[model samples]
Target: MASANVVDNSDHSRFDLLVDDKPAGLVAYSRRGDNIELVHTEVDPAYEGHGYGSLLARSALDAARAEGLRVWPLCPFIQSFLKQHPEYLDLVPQTQVTRFKLA
Candidate 1:
């Protein structure tokens, strides 16, 4: 596994995904006063299929968990990635899971 750093770009209110010194992917989201929703997960086409997206998702979810934050994955890729990786399911809100059909 590559050393992917999941950094909080609080200034921009997004998550910056870095891998091997390159910006391989990103998970963008916003806080609506209370709940934080995952708006998007984009892996550079050149970095796709290398599990970097999954890595990015994992890191992002971990951050949410650490902050006691609930996630609403509006991005299809983030939703599907969470479905495939049920281990991280605990990080997402139970109600939100149903919306993603992960419940």
Candidate 2:
């Protein structure tokens, strides 16, 4: 896998993704207890097919993982990504696992 050049902007808090000096996409989250609610995510139309959204989600997920926080991905893309990529399964809240259809 080719390493993605994902930058953690804004002091490890709000996360945004820029590709080649342009705003390619972004992911927003709010911390709730030991879980972070993944609020939103979007990829520029031009950047949609290049997996930029996934890059943002992965970076945010990585941050949550480091903090020992379970994730509640309300963003549809991140929710779908969670389903597709099972390796990150441990990062999801066990109670919501059924809602996310991870079982």
Candidate 3:
């Protein structure tokens, strides 16, 4: 199994996924006050079907949790992810939970 690692590249507003030290995927986001708006998630075609996308999403959300920030899942992928992973629901702000249908 390949070693997977996730790194936050705040300079580019994205969290990168490295599979065995190679670029595999990324989660793009924007910091809004105390919230992090997930804008998009992409995995390299060659790296697809290997669970890299989920890794990216999990890492990004974990970062938000560590930073004490809220999550605004603007990307369709993130919206779906959040719905499936209700354990992270608390990271979503109460005011916007209904908008994202996570309530």
Local distance difference test, per candidate? 0.82, 0.78, 0.91
Question: Evaluated with lDDT, which candidate comes out highest?
Answer: 3
Best by TM-score: 3
TM-score of each predicted structure versus truth: 0.85, 0.83, 0.93
Tell me the tens digit of each residue's lDDT in model 2 across 1-103: 3334556564644677876666677787788789888878877797778778878888988888998998887778888888888878798877777887865
Residue-level lDDT of model 1, residues 10-97, one tens digit each, is 8887888788878877888998754678898898998788888887788888888888888888889888988888887876778888
Which residue pairs does candidate 1 place in steric collision? none
Instruction: Name the TM-score of candidate 3.
Output: 0.93
Model 2: lDDT of residue 85: 81
Full ranking by lDDT: 3, 1, 2
Stretches of candidate 2 above 4 Å error?
1-4, 9-13
Q: Which ten residues in a row have the lowest lDDT in candidate 2?
A: 1-10
